[model samples]
Every structure is written in structure tokens, then in C-alpha cells.
Target: MLEARDMTLTELADQVGITIANLSILKNGRAKAIRFTTLTKLCEVLSCQPGDLLTFDPD
Candidate 1:
């Protein structure tokens, strides 16, 4: 998604009022949970829906 938008992690973090490390965690799929507020901010900046950011994986 970031790639599609030509956005960098640092830029996202700055726009979302989050830290690069935290965004990095989400980027790496190491996040256990994401707050609705944060999710909304991400969608707002990236011009995407939550479904665009979420995926269902069965392992």
C-alpha cells in the first residue's frame, strides 16, 4: 500500500503522529493489534479503506 502510494515509512509516521519504529512494526506484520484511531489515520493519509490494509490468513 505504501509502495502503491509512493509513501515512505518516515513520512507516514510523521503524518500519522506515530513513531517510525511503531509503523515499522506494523509494516513488518509484527503488530498484535492496531487501534481504531490509528487505523483511521492511516486510511485517511493513504487514501485507502481498512479492507485495503487488512487481510485474512489462516495458518
Candidate 2:
């Protein structure tokens, strides 16, 4: 979605009121959890549904 929306991590973080480092952690899939509020902010900024930003992997 970032690619499709032409958004940079810094830009997204700024827009979402999150820190770049924290967003970077999430981007790297190192985050163990995400708050619903954060998810909602991301969806609103990215104009996407939760499914659009996530995937199911049975690793």
C-alpha cells in the first residue's frame, strides 16, 4: 500500500502520529502486536482495509 500510495515511511509516520523507529519495526515485521487505534490510523491514511495490509502465513 505504501508503494501504491507513493508514501515514504517517514511521511507515513508523521501522518499517523507514530515514530519512524516504531513504524520501522512494524515494517520489518518485528512488532509482536499492533493497537487497534494504530491500525485504524494506518487504514485511514493508506485508504485501505486491514486485510490489504496483512497476510496469513502459516510459518
Best by TM-score: 1
Residues 1-59, candidate 1: write the lDDT tens digits.
Answer: 88999999999999999999999998888888999999999999999999998877765
lDDT of 2 by residue, 1-59 (tens): 89999999999999999999999998888888899999999999999999987766767
How displaced is residue 14 in candidate 2, in Å? 0.4
- What value does the lDDT take at residue 16 in candidate 1? 97
Model 2 residue 10 CA deviation in Å: 0.6
- Minimal lDDT window, size 10, model 2: 50-59
What's the TM for model 2? 0.89
Off by over 4 Å in 1: none
RMSD to true structure for each model, in Å: 1.0, 1.1
Off by over 4 Å in 2: none
